[model samples]
Target: MLLAVEGLTHRYGDKTALDQFTMHLNRREIVGLLGPNGSGKSTLLRVLSTLVKPQTGRVEICGFDAGKLPEAVRSRIGVVFQTPTLDPLLTVEENLLIFGSFFGISGRALHERVRHLMQQFGILDRRTDFAKTLSGGLRRRAEIARALLHEPQLLIFDEPTSGLDPAARDDFWKAIEELREKRSTAILISTHLFDEAERCDSLILLHRGLRVAEGTPAELKATIGGQIVELVAKKPEAALETLRAKFGAAIELSDGILRVEAKDAHQMIPSLVEALPGEVLSVGLHQPTLADVFRKVTA
Candidate 1:
């Protein structure tokens, strides 16, 4: 294991942030921490990256105990926070140079490393541009480039694609995939986006400061074992109660829509429609997705 978290627990005043959370992370695998807001994803990242110490538990990164040997753990991991850390006044190359210096990287070696990383991120052409002038996507690429300057073994990103448009998000993920192939480094990213979570090799689903489930996306979705039925109904609450009572279905009202998980849902759809009659405005059935899996586990 490249990373091991054992019985980690953290609390803030009256509320618990992490409750005996534990997991193992393999080298070169992309593991996503998937959760809604306030799910302890950020707290876990903070603990893993040594920004904050957990009240209890052990975190070993690259064989170094994070609590006792933070410097060693810090040397082997790169972190990209949800907020950009680039100085707006500095050019892309300057920002990378400053970050490289923190790792005692200087002179010709730093230059070559910066050049290589810039090329890898497709931002070599933008190296001379001030960070404030770059678009959101370009700035994100620059942030990633800076993070890789030291060639850390583990890279951590917290909602790296947040606030990006579809095209920018696509570009950012392409860069991540390219880096994964080129570096063969372990990656851990926290995200609430289903599309982003689906790209990970494994997932840890968190809810209200506890780990709810963990598996590959396909494996997690397989736990549902059938189709997901979503109904936009005129009276979703009533429909949900009626359906759950009549069919004993696993159902709920989310975003004013009735959602259900059923075996062979396509075959049962007609009956559901017939039974609901005028209550349902529209219905949709599909294979269980990461979103469905999240709902099932979190619920």
Candidate 2:
């Protein structure tokens, strides 16, 4: 395993941040760490990258123990933190040079590395531009490039595209895809967005401090089975509990919207109209999405 974590546990005083987490990543695999707030996804990344100490369990990245061999582990893994770390006063190239120095890289070699990374990210034109002047997407690309200066086999990104616009997000993924093609880099990505998870080779969905489910996007979606029935109701909140208790595991509530995985939503419509305060606004029968499976698993 390129990255292996087993029975990992972490705590802050009496509160548990991670509870018995177990997962792994192979070379060239992109694993998405997905969860709601405070679900331990970030905590897992912190431990794997050697930024935080775990109360229990082991993290072996590229055969080096993260806790026991801190220097060796840090040398092999690259991290792009969720918070902004780039200096606003420094230009993109300058930032890369400064970070590359940490890896004992400098002179022509470091410049060449920065050039290659900026070209890969399509930011060579902005190499001299200060990070503060770059768009959200460009800054993210720079940050990722900075992380890659040492040519680490594994790359960790936390909420990489959280505030990016649509075009920039697409551009970021394009860069990552190119990175995957060129280096076959094992990427560990943490994100709250389901669409972001879809881009990964596999996903681990979490709630609170536990891993609720983990698999390929297709495998996770397959957990729900059959078609999803979206019930457009007039009184969604009021009707949700009744439908769920009646429909059991098939029913789901999101905002005023309701979803049920059933073979025959059309057949069930008449009954809903008669009992519900409003007529059926609409009913959609479609294949279950990753979100649907996540809902069922996390509910």
Candidate 3:
């Protein structure tokens, strides 16, 4: 395992941040940490990056015990925090140089590494531009370039695309895919965006600081089974009872919406419309998606 965590738990006074969270990551894989706000994603990243110590747990990164040898673990991991860390006043190349120096890289070797990263990230032409003058997309690329200067075994990102526009987000993901292909670096990124999560090789879904589910996007969606039927009705609870009674369907009713799973939802929709009559305001049927799976698991 490139990374392994077991029985990881953390607390802030009376509130629990992580409850027996456990996960394993392999080399050359991108794993996404997924959850809503306050689900312990940030806390988990902090612990893994050695920024915050867990109250109880075992963590191993790149064959080194994270809890006992934090420095060794740190040396093997690169972290891009949720907030931008680049110095706005520094030029793009200068920023990379500063970050590289922190890893004891210097002289001709550091310059060569910096040039390689700049070229690889396609920011070589912008090397002399101040960080503040670059667009959001370019700055994000620079941040990633800086993080890779040390060539760490694992790279962790915390909502790295938080404020990026759609085009910028896509560009960032392209860079991520390139990293995987070129360096074979194991990646673990946290994000609330469902589309971003879908790009991951696998996902760990968290709820209230505990892992509720884990799988590839396809595997996770498959758990919902067949097709998903969503209905907006005047009386959701009543519609839920009717649907369950008539079709023996597994139903979920919340917030004026009723959802059920069926093998042939298209055939069943007509029957539903007939049975519900005027109660159903709208109906939709589709195959399960990551967003749907997340909703079901976290509900």
Candidate 4:
């Protein structure tokens, strides 16, 4: 196991940030922490990164107990935080060198590592460019490369693609996938984005400081066990009432939209339209997705 967390819990005075969370990760596996805001995703990452010690339970990284051997854990793990960390005034190469120097790497070894990482991440051409001059995607790539300079076995990222455009996000994930394949690194990513969560090998879904569900993306979606029928109604409340009378608990009202989950939902559409009788402005049906799984588990 590259990372092992057991019965982890943390609290902030009256608020419980984490509650009996347990998970294990293996080498070269990508596991995503999927949750909404205030769901303890950040708190979990903080504890794993050793920035915040867990109030109870154990966190072992690369065979080192985080509480007993924080330095060892830190050395074995690399973290890329949600916010930017590079110095805008420094060149990309300068930023990486400075970060590596903190790990006591220097001279020829440091230079070679930097060159390899930059080349691997496709940022060597931008090595001389100031951090402020790089685009959001390039800066993110540089930061990931910097994190790997110390050759940590585990890489932890917290919403690493935040604020990036779709194309940039795609490029970032491509690099991450390549890194895992080539280095056999274990990765833990915390994200609220559905697309990003879907790319993980498995996911731990959290809600209000508790683990709500855990499984591969396909497994979780399969738990929903049906199709989703969504409609925007002309009179949402009335439509909801009408639908509820027919579909019972299978139908729910969210954001002024009526959603129904049923086996073979496509066959139900005609009945739904007839039941609502022009109240629905538009309707759509699709297979269950990660978003649907989240809604089901959280609801």
Model 2 lDDT, full chain set: 0.82
Candidate 2 residue 49 Cα shift, in angstroms, is 1.6
The regions of model 1 sitting more than 4 angstroms off are 164-183
Candidate 3, superposed: residue stretches over 4 Å from native: 165-171, 233-249, 253-257, 279-281
Candidate 3, residues 37-59, lDDT tens digits: the string is 89899899999999887689888
Q: Using TM-score as the measure, which candidate wins? A: 4
lDDT of 1 by residue, 109-180 (tens): 999999988886678999999999998778888887788788888889998877667766776677667667
Question: What is candidate 4's lDDT per residue for 75-128, written digit by digit as tens?
Answer: 788999988889999999999999999899999999999999898777899999
True lDDT of residue 225, candidate 3: 78
Provide the overall lDDT of each model, using Cα atoms, as 2-decimal numbers: 0.87, 0.82, 0.88, 0.89
How much is 284 displaced in model 3, in angstroms?
1.9
From the highest lDDT down, the ranking of the candidates is: 4, 3, 1, 2
Instruction: Give each model a TM-score.
Output: 0.93, 0.90, 0.87, 0.93
List clash counts for every candidate, in order: 0, 0, 0, 0
**lDDT tens per residue, model 2, 247-295:** 6756677867777776666576666556565646877767888878777
Give the distance in Å from residue 173's predicted Cα in candidate 3 to where it truly belongs.
3.7
Question: What ranking emerges by TM-score with the best candidate at the front?
Answer: 4, 1, 2, 3
lDDT for position 210 in model 1? 94
Question: Cα RMSD (Å) per model?
Answer: 1.9, 2.2, 2.6, 1.8
Pick by TM-score: 2 or 3, better one: 2
Candidate 2 regions with alpha-carbon error over 4 angstroms: 241-249, 277-279
